[model samples]
Target: MTAIKPGLKLKSAVCSAEVMVIKAPAGASLTCGGAPMIGAKDDAPAGAALDPQAAGGCQVGKRYVNAEQSLEVLCTKAGEGSLAADGTALELKEAKKLPSSD
Candidate 1:
């Protein structure tokens, strides 16, 4: 688990996915490709591969949020891995509906 904060950049250990933290709760564990994400400046371990079960693929420019919506991250780069928090897969945050000007 990492102490995440807004503006912190992270990269996947097993894929090319990268993200910036927008909002994160304390003690949240961010994962990509079923492996814990590492700091953007850190080097990934040797022989790391994408997890077949978590290969949902990440989309660039998308916002992913946890079930409680407390943890959110913006995808800075796309890759063949999905985002997850605390073992639960994060979902794409839907755009807010605007009121009609009738």
Candidate 2:
């Protein structure tokens, strides 16, 4: 996989999920719906099929990140697929807690 960089947009080859790179480490493999994500301007493979095991369903307007904090993606469209990096699933970024006024 090519080195992913911030501001790069990607689209799922198997589903409608779309994402923009927030932060990505060099040499990381980004995937959506169990298939390699392509450039945002590129079209999905005509006969591609979704992998059942990777169908965790992504949420629109959500941010996903890996445990290592080396990769981050912001979903632009929702789809029946989960985000991953090098075969490991990414988790939704937790919401930040608000500071107390007291």
Candidate 3:
């Protein structure tokens, strides 16, 4: 079953992420910090599930969406929580800028 999902991109320069497919219960949702996501369906895209607190806390879910396994998440940048080609996060204060050759 496929559905149109509207969500934010996850990535930055200093921090990075991986997409994976997890084995979780039917209706579980994966959360990083507090944001929720599903398995990235598009080729260049990006989900979630699994109880990190449980004893067998290996990172997997119905569609974990991480670098360890999934491919859709490749669309987002590594950090700063924005799309790879987006301008808002690319202009971060700590981000380095190349000097103009002129």
Candidate 4:
């Protein structure tokens, strides 16, 4: 068995305001938002609006669209993991032994 190490780390990287979300499954009849974007998933049927109290707020996999207005979306960290970034998995490092101080 092998233990995996951490990789590259980029702190709060400020990206410009051109934020984009690409939906999948493109077609000609639909409103084409230009190339590079595949478009919305028509295969994925229109989802049901969720109740906040029932769902305990929005989840990841469970599909739901925001139907409510003036909802205070308090963006909080659900959990945290080892902060890693793009790059090689770091060179396989060998553990070094220290000399006896005695």
The most accurate candidate by TM-score is 1
Q: What would the TM-scores of all predictions be?
A: 0.91, 0.89, 0.25, 0.15
- Count of backbone clashes for each model? 0, 0, 26, 2
In model 1, where do residues sit more than 4 Å from their true spots? 97-102
Displacement of residue 90 (Cα, Å) in model 1 is: 0.3
- Tens-digit per-residue lDDT, 2-83, candidate 4: 1111221111111100111112112211111111111122121234222222223222122211122111111111111111
Off by over 4 Å in 2: 97-102
**Poorly placed runs, candidate 4 (over 4 Å):** 1-80
Top lDDT prediction, candidate number = 1
Error of 4 at 95 (Å): 2.7
Clashing pairs in 2: none
Give the per-residue lDDT digits (tens) of candidate 3, residues 4-102: 223433322222333332222233333332233333442322232222332121121112232322222223322222221111111111225689989
Structural RMSD, model 2: 2.8
| Clash pairs (backbone) in predicted model 1 | none
Query: What are the clashing pairs of model 4?
Result: 23-39, 24-39
Candidate 2, residues 8-84: lDDT per residue as tens digits?
88889999899999999878888888899998778777888789999998999899999987889999999898889
Q: How far off is residue 44 in model 2, in Å?
A: 1.9
